[model samples]
Target: MKILTTPDIPIATLFQNMREVYATCNVDVSWASEEVLNLPALNIVDVGTCILGSTTAEQNQLFTHRNSAGSNDIVIYFVEATDPPFNGCASHPLGMPGAVVVRTATQWTFAHEQGHVLGLNHVNDNDRLMTGNGTANITNPPPDLVASECNTMQASPITVNV
Candidate 1:
């Protein structure tokens, strides 16, 4: 995973937390980061904008980072706080998957979005990592990574980095 942050903020703790969380899945993540992006959160969206409500201009600004798949990397863009939203964007491009997380996001939000990046879909059960839309708290979810999802994640190109 490559974490992209604004020049003024730090994301090392969040990165470490994500590493710890992914450890339970036996996915060893190697990371690199760029903390010199001059852009701020408000520059991309309105002060209280929802992460998912990324406008074309905002997405274009984000795409400027060129998060392509030459390395099959999953990118994470850390921004400042937002309004009452899901915390960040968990978007999976057709060939390259990535996420956008707020500074307030917990480790679960990172892992949950990573699940989507790895081709996992949302489930109705709140006990699972892929649970949300209707009921997903910031707390612990149950132990569940179905065999199929595991296979899919294992098959991804980012597995090479593991």
Candidate 2:
């Protein structure tokens, strides 16, 4: 879904970046729909709040309140600002199901948020996607995932259905 002031982001390019960001992971990355070459893909706008603060009327309460976000369906909400410290976030309240918020829609942002959707958490490794406050730089490598993380991600109910 499109958030206020984010229709101008380059979704196709950024999405590709996300795919590359998770290349090392066991999960596959594909557009939810066709490739959006336009500056603003979807025009429908709504409340696009960061994962850490969902108190606003627009943020998804189900995720923010339950203490579980980005554990379910990948809802990529494009907002207009980078006020939030994180580039993206998992949106699910139960089991990490939720939408991914992309202010800049960078490749790292997409992949980092997806990491959360896959039930992965942050780490101290700067070289990994799970690094605390994952980087948006394209030069960085993909997020790191061990056999266990891959197993957990692959076995998740959401991934299985996909």
- Leading candidate by TM-score: 1
Worst 10 residues of 1 by lDDT: 44-53
Cα lDDT of model 2 by residue, 1-162, tens digit: 333344344667667766664555546765543222223322222334544334333344323332222344455555443334445555444443445454555556656666666667777767666677556542346545666677767776777444
For all candidates in order, the CA lDDT equals 0.56, 0.52
Estimate the TM-score of every prediction: 0.68, 0.63
User: How many backbone collisions does model 1 have?
Assistant: 0
Worst 10 residues of 2 by lDDT: 35-44
Local accuracy of candidate 1 as per-residue lDDT tens digits, 28-100: 7766545335565543333233333243345445645644335477776666643345566655334445666
Model 1: CA > 4 A from native = 1-10, 41-55, 66-70, 81-84, 92-96, 133-143
